[model samples]
Target: MSHSKHSSLSHDRHPLNFQDTYICPICRHGHIESLTLMDVFACDFCRHIFTANLKDQSIHVENSSQPMTWRWTGRNWQAANQLDVDLTVVIWLVSVSLVILPPSLIWLSSHAFPPLVGSSGSWFPAFWVGLTFTLHFLFVSWLMAEHYQFPLYVSTKVRLRRLLDRR
Candidate 1:
């Protein structure tokens, strides 16, 4: 007799009401409130607009470049159209490419374009190799730090810029 196919939201005392405020799925820090009498909702923190499907118990971001949908699962919101990507495969591919691509490109370029006549070939190639390796190392380090949730404060950089703001 309930309307929702997933659960009919039967667990709830009643269906979601327009007056109800739910956590913004896009920006977890913000709260979503109904926009006037329309079916649209807006997040206070991220200023994202979302459309709600009360019957299906799903909501989708309207203002984002890539609108994503999430369904209320009684206890929490779950991604509705989330892809089935394997984390290990993704990590391995990215890591391997980071380690291999730059060096291969450097090697191929050195072979293809010989140094100009009288140009200092020795120091330039060494410098290029060192710079490439250092850049690759930094990229890999940042990726691992992000993926593993390293104890290091993520302010990392996102917050340093905010230092000018009054506390």
Candidate 2:
């Protein structure tokens, strides 16, 4: 729904065909659940997981070497929560646009304003404008990086997998 560049990819770019199907990661059977967010086919029968990203396909097979396990996190479950990677990308794009676009329009406006153009004064105003612009850009960049840097759902899954494997 967002006008962000990554919006399409985040929401509905890769529609998965659950019926086309792939092998289950756990039982090695041919029944896998299409988990588009994780970009993987998950085995419902044995809880195995694998990803079929365009770059490469990696399988997380359920075997003696890597057993399956699950855990509880004290948070309400939601589709948006599960799709953190996509959500983060969308947020980053929107935030960057918001930060850069408005000030740019204003800067252009000052140039177009004939009354404000002809006269010049101290360098202090220009210095202040540059300082504010830099601060705003830096602030938005930091926020975007912080928001997308750690997708909670994926990190949680990875942590749970590690814990389960240990036991």
Candidate 3:
């Protein structure tokens, strides 16, 4: 039900028929066949259940944490709600914020509420800035790794071991 976008192909599609064997859009390996005497379809390989909308020629994955939907195109299935989130734009925005925000915040805070003359300690701002930069950098790195299919997210223990071995 969460799947909103219904991206259909230019070619026309036929409605679901139990006689035909449609490939499972979710697993991409199984055939989606209707369960005997049931309205829902089940994938043989992935065992994922799907509910069909014959009117729209769409099948929705059932009991999934994040609902996924696909439309039958009379040949292959296409994602119904694939957003194609661009990591490049996301990375760029995060990088820009990483370079700009911390320093700007420090400068604005200093001017907005002038620090006490004697109580001023530069270390606090420095620490805050460092923490902010580190967090942003880690997030961007993870996003990049995922986009590029890098092995950086292999395992926490492996990463810790690699970190310790660096010394």
> What TM-score fits each model?
0.54, 0.32, 0.45
Overlapping backbone residue pairs in candidate 1 total: 0
In candidate 1, stretches whose alpha carbon ends up further than 4 angstroms from where it belongs are 1-15, 84-100, 107-167
Q: List, residue by residue over 1-167, the lDDT tens digit for candidate 2.
A: 22331332243333233333443323333355566655556655445565443332233333323222221111111122133578758877887776777667656665565334445754445555576678878888666544433234334554678689899
Residue 77 of model 2: what lDDT? Answer: 12
Q: Better model by TM-score, 1 or 2?
A: 1
Q: Please give the lDDT score for candidate 3.
A: 0.65
Q: Higher-lDDT candidate among 1 and 2? A: 1
Per-residue lDDT tens digits for candidate 3, residues 88-158, read: 57767877787678767876775677656667684566666667767767876775554442223423434
After superposition, candidate 3 runs with Cα above 4 Å error: 1-14, 82-167
* Candidates, ranked, lDDT: 1, 3, 2
- Model 1, position 165, has a per-residue lDDT of 54
Please report the candidate that would top TM-score against the real structure.
1
Taking every candidate in turn, the Cα RMSD to the unseen true structure, in Å, is 8.9, 16.9, 11.5
Model 2 vs. true fold: TM: 0.32
In model 3, the number of clashes is 0
Give the Å shift of residue 115 in candidate 3: 33
Off by over 4 Å in 2: 1-85, 114-129, 148-167
